[model samples]
Target: MASSKPKPDPLSIQRGDYARTLAGPLLLGLGRMVSIPLQHWLLTAHPLSHFGIPRPPSDGVLELPLVGAQPQLSTIFLGMTATLILKQNAWIWGYCAERITVPFAFFGVVVPAMYECLSALVFSYASSNPLWRKEFLYVGAAVHFFAAAVELGSELARARFKGRIENRGRLYKGGAWGLVRHPNYAANVVYGAAYGFAAGGPVYALFTGAFYWSNLTGNATPAKENYLAERYPEEWEQYKKDVPWKMFLGIF
Candidate 1:
């Protein structure tokens, strides 16, 4: 009889897996670098106006005013003025304190702070009036605001979630976790793609996705699973049974 085929190793990294590990980050980074500037460059180089679009800087400088180089400006605030109602634990300090460095945490605090400021700068610089007719300051702000809120609320609930903990810092229940096991990660994918969309040009659309992908591999992957699994054994396994992966809203 022919020898039994060698069994694939469960822990071994496959060729495709390694390629994906490299490709995701590389593509995302390259996409951002290539698109954003290309859009800006396209806006600035023209002398004659196209389709009634306003003109950009004649000197060919991309101010990146979103970075706060503009004068007499302010921010756009979209926040949880209303307290997020959620279950808390005496031992967990309300879930917000534990994962202080999470992306959703930074997004909550940062996006609103910069939204109006960036929009104001983009318009002030003009670079040839709105690249797309569908673009608007309110729309972009709303998108970022919504995504940030979802991410933040979900993350907070996750921190205090009671369930499996492959690690001391991880879990499998609570908040958005009850719906989608990878709520934070799902939010990242949404907002990452939306950032380029909000930028309102093909350039950002092409590149920003790569950044999110890279970010997921580096930050969201093990932090959400393997790390916790190693720390907490029985709880995590049970949590996995209680919730499904990527179900952010609900499961029927």
Candidate 2:
């Protein structure tokens, strides 16, 4: 009887990703925390609050309390995402740079703008109304952080495989990469939904989730796959055969 190939241990490898420099991840995490909040404040409270002027009664403004359970919950939820971004930066900057490239400027410019606009609007609409129950907030935060964890795992896996193979140019399939062709993208979509819920409520989650889906499927995934296919034809084809879904499990 032939023995089956041993599965790679997900936690067994380290490529000195953190030893290089933590500045990048720390900055990124800080940026992540400020990104949406700055947008939210600018569109809602900043003009008045910054200038010490009384906020005029307006139906279109976000009126989240200065301190409350809802705002606190939002902060905690968003904070976890920011923390994960910092934690995962080592894997992303270390491993992803080898095989990944900015396929288009749209992702760098347009998508984030869209997300900010959507989030700002959601906050404006939902901040006053207590649309999120405590239970729902707890569940949403768990899902968000879980997806962030998955993203971190995927990056670590890629870095580990790259280290093991000693091939800087080929696709690495050691850790979470084996579970899905694009685990990062899958996790992003899941986290987006969680962010949406935290930002606004269920309605916001729907909008954010749809945006992530479109961004991943319509723009990012195809471009990445095409580049990989061109760069590593035989390996890419074999990879597709082994891992069929572009993102997530049998869903995509």
Candidate 3:
């Protein structure tokens, strides 16, 4: 019988290869920049109005004064952009993984770009509705900002813990980790839904929330748990007992 290869220790994975770290964020930023102009055109110019695209109300809440060539920004737009900027910086600086794989990076870029573009489209489509409230936009923006802060803070806490020499090979169980096994994942869902809500409304918010919840729970969270189990067999089991929740407390 042939000998099986030994599984590499998870702790051996290095952090932050410049090329891999930078590539994902740069690509994401490019995609976002492109989406901005597209969003502006969709909202203002209504270039696709002939193709069943309903024109936004000339005096709609979405219609703000233009600043030079660009449409005047809204709270929703600012929240979305700020979230992306925060995430990009986190990936470049705070993420502990050394090499972000090409497929994952591409997935990250494509998913967010699609979400942003589609959300804008949906929002524009719904703008003519008399029931659509501007307060939803402002409230969603606040939630988005709060979610971003939580995500960043939790990730930074973990990163700082991992950076300590004495903490090498040890599991992080403090800060937000004490609250849930995956606070960052929880925050991801919040911000994603918040962005959707701010961009469109309840329908978009539910869509985004469901998408993120499913993705994280079905894929990302399980994969991470398995990795942690392998890396810290005894500690992983204990941590699960201690935390009791995977991502959201009293929910998952």
**Candidate whose TM-score is highest:** 3
Candidate 3 lDDT, 18-56, residue by residue in tens: 344566546554554566666665667665566675664
TM-score per candidate, in order? Answer: 0.46, 0.65, 0.80
Supply candidate 3's per-residue lDDT for 236: 91
The global Cα lDDT (0 to 1) of model 1 is 0.44
- Arranged by TM-score, best first: 3, 2, 1
lDDT of 2 by residue, 119-168 (tens): 65454444354674445556777888889888877777666666765676
Cα lDDT of model 1 by residue, 1-252, tens digit? 899845433322221122233333333223223323333343344324445555533322223445634221112211111111111122123332222222332343344324323432343344454463234333544665676678777765555453335534445465677766677667666665555454444455345555666667565565557645755778778887777564335531
Full-model lDDT, candidate 2: 0.61
Q: Lowest summed lDDT over 10 consecutive residues: which window, candidate 3?
A: 9-18
